[model samples]
Target: MEPLNIQANQLILLRLPSQNIKVVKVEPGSIISLGKFGSFRADDIIGDPFGFTYEIDSGMKLSLVDNTIEFDEDDQMGAEQAMTGHKITATGMQQLTSEEIEALKSQGVSGAEIIAKVMEGHAAFEHKTEYSKEKYLKRKKQKFLQQFTPYAIGSTELIDIYLDKDPTRIYNLSPETLALALNMGNIRPGGNYLVVDETPGVLVAAILERIGGEGTITLVHENEHPNLDCLKYLVLSEEERERMIKTINWLELFHPEESEPVRTKTAEELEDLKPSHRRQYYRAKQREENHKEILKRADTCGFDALMVMTLLDLPTLIPQLLRFVGGSRPIVLYSEFKEVLVETTLALQKENRVLAPTIMETRVRKYQTLPGRIHPLMTSRGYGGYLLSALRVHPNRAVNAVGKIS
Candidate 1:
């Protein structure tokens, strides 16, 4: 059998007994070890272009360094250092049975000792972030307790719970993390992009950080009254804020017959207009200005492309959305579950105008266990969602199997 190959920008998912996680490995094996559960050779992990799963038939030998047991060493020294932070190293991973892990837990063993035993097998473990020894101890305790069981929730349930919480327990991505995802999406500088997202400030903040050149962004919402209160946290320069174009009540603009047309006086016809007619024209012009102001906060314009990241029912929104994105563009949709996204994928396929739309999922896994443990490793967390991408084809072209309108 051939060894698995890993690729850049690829979404990787690893499911462990404790939890599932998703992550995009931007760099090859940069200190990604499971701490004590087990470790892998990062150099060996990077060269696999195709992903594979395997178990070591026998235990592998790891290089070890001796530590001098000295008296008067500050207990806080190592704990304080952990406060800075540490990365996972792909070395020193040992596979133990679950029975071994259970025994340690039953003995009231400390998590620090467990993590240390797992880490001692690797030499690449380094501290790069600021960490305090005390905080590190607390964190390790949490990690030990968190490994007890896995928590699973549906997408809707998660959204409902998170939205209601003042200080949510959910770990959401920041602008930097979102930037990483955007790069995975192949977003480029100086390109017009369309965005439909509920988190206005967060979405825009991420875009500003990654977008370069003179590219334009069009933000869309359900109505002229955009719920952009969350955006207040995104501090933007006066000049940069002015560059954004907005549109409000997206449904009204895209839905036909929602806008009423008013007659305008051409130069040839103006000569024949009476004073009374001229008065009506001026009044209509005033109304237009008033309407524009009411929607100003939510209205953006001059979009060279389209993207939908907002919260709307896909079944109802897709038809209306199709009208906005004529052929020759790309539509990328993100979902937390395969079920919610499968409908959209099928809808695009029925349209028969989409190109080879790709559907994929991603996850990140961490292997960690204590010395003399039975379980080889445990999973850390689930960190990815589903992705469906399709290109809008123009009228005069062939559509692919996944629905690409050429």
Candidate 2:
């Protein structure tokens, strides 16, 4: 595999000091104006590697910084200093007027120099405790720093961005639950998967990343056209996109029909046809062939795994989807509400088509991990969502097992 580089026309994630992220297209010779922070020519960072931090200033130059750090430990120390103290006086602490701050910004001073000047003018700088002092400096840096990190956007980073922007867009799915579903389904390269993704396309993109160009994802969507908007951000070549992803409607998958026969032509006949007619003839033939293959796969019932992330009623959805998955293959379902999955699990249990249906949820608690002030953060997202997973199996009546009826 080639090492992924920041290429022109590809989407890259820019993470700001304020912990806000922006998805930007890397177009060469274009100016990327980050508003107040600063602006830089896209050419400066076009060929650079992903996951590097760059500081932009009025000089229109880019300075690279190595950002590899242990995030948990660093986050804890930073949080402890910021939140483990009494609220400081919002007014009268800093003597620099708004005009002075704007002048400094316009002058294109380095982030450190600006922060130092702000601290020097702060009337209560000497009175603050050591931890409080660190907190103030950090806050000032976040506000005035003209710095942004360009990270290689992957599933987890994309999820964080969506969660912050609009939870409803991705059904409030979390990285933890997404990981669980992938593991439970045993998703890997070269496997064929049946997916119903109403999370728009995050789930489909994640699967594509794991499977690469080898595996196939037959995505089932409710409407006539599939909603895979998230795939627009992926930096995939045309060949990879065509080789890995395929889409089908729910009605087509469930009630497939033989496609109309397309007219055929000999090599001589095709050469003699008009250019436009030849192109149309080839397209029709390809569509008919693809439809036949999809219908065959649907009828064969041998998908490697079945993964679904949708808001539709699961109890009614799962049973219908399970029929397309082969025996002993994993079936994983994700929902924002546990109640939704619980109902599906009960139905699967009653039908005896799945083995040991289980509902599981994973939550991550962040903390301020200083030696003396370590504790959970005061505010965090309350839910990370839930997963209902089970394996499709064949029920044998020839020999009685402990849980089987004779």
Candidate 3:
């Protein structure tokens, strides 16, 4: 793993107290705002390791928070309170007004102090059940806490940030589904892969992590150019991208020269171009040659695996890519709806082109794991969609069993 310190100009995820995540580019001397929560100088956090949590002081200064810190009010509340009935009072549930809270802010009150003040003002706070009081305090802290945690960017972080911002963009795919897809696809280092990723690039990003930038990925895209926008979130350089990633559109893959009109220039013609134009010419020629080489290899040797995550009609796509997938290889498709994959699965079965076509769904529900307080967490992600997977095979061949007809 790379050193986990915050780097200058690196993209990082800042998770705020309100459970809202912000994608920020850390530039020295600049300040990133968390709306009403607070803002901190980017330089203040530079060089810190990944797991430190920072609390913003009134002067915008940052101080490290203890990892084992607990709320004062919460620590005082006992489980016995959970069984106690409410004691009704004329002051009602809460008496703090917005104007008063703003005045407290102007007085430079910290978030914990503000929470304590609110608890004190609530006439029925102690009378309420422990769980109810805990919820109320937590909601207030989420709103008022001037703290944030910075997370290093990775496949899981990108998926979470993207899912939180726009689930539809990533086919509502979850981490569990990505894991399952990768396991089923058998992605590994130094393996050739054919993929069609329309989650713009989330699926491609996942594959790269598993492959470890050691193999080529022939990403067949729908548009004129592949949407390699994943580079925005990933830490790939131009050289690494050129080495491990190959992109081809439908036209470029199937009708190579017809779409590009590759014109060969003689040595004499190359000498006629200016220095800058000559450099550009050679780069374009190299790209063309590389594309041809990848296509030829896929055609002759076939890819080790095939994975796709797109809304395109699968019936049309499977035939084009399956031919390039070697026998006994895996083909995996991800769809937000099971209905979309049903048609694709049946067609593959009818053609006898694959074995054991299966549709899988992985749902994860987390719980509070503290021994006595164990139960499901109140909020959990209900997304991950579905996967259709099968192994490519040559139906024309008959195989002999190694074991004696078990």
Pick the TM-score winner: 3
lDDT of 2 by residue, 251-296 (tens): 6676665434676899999999999999889966765666667667
Can you tell me which runs of candidate 1 are displaced by over 4 Å? 1-181, 260-305, 326-328, 366-379, 395-406
Where model 2 places Cα greater than 4 Å from the true spot, the runs are: 1-3, 66-109, 120-139, 258-284, 298-301, 368-374, 399-406
List, residue by residue over 59-151, the lDDT tens digit for candidate 1.
321222122121111233464454443444545565434576567655645434554543444344344222343234334444552221111
Q: Which residue pairs in candidate 3 collide?
A: none
31 Cα displacement, candidate 3 (Å):
1.6
lDDT top scorer: 3
Tens digit per residue, CA lDDT, model 3, 1-406: 1238998888998888777888999999999888887888999998999898888877788987764243454444455753342333334446779888888877777777787777778887757765785588668878777888999877788788879888888889999999999999999999889989987688788888888869888888898778766557777787877787788778787777676545888999889999998988887787787788777876787898899998889977787778889889999999988987898888886776788899999998876433234457777777688999999987653333343232
RMSD of 3: 4.4
TM-score of candidate 3 to 2 decimals: 0.84
lDDT of 2: 0.78
For all predicted structures, in order, the TM-scores are 0.45, 0.82, 0.84
Arrange candidates, best lDDT first: 3, 2, 1
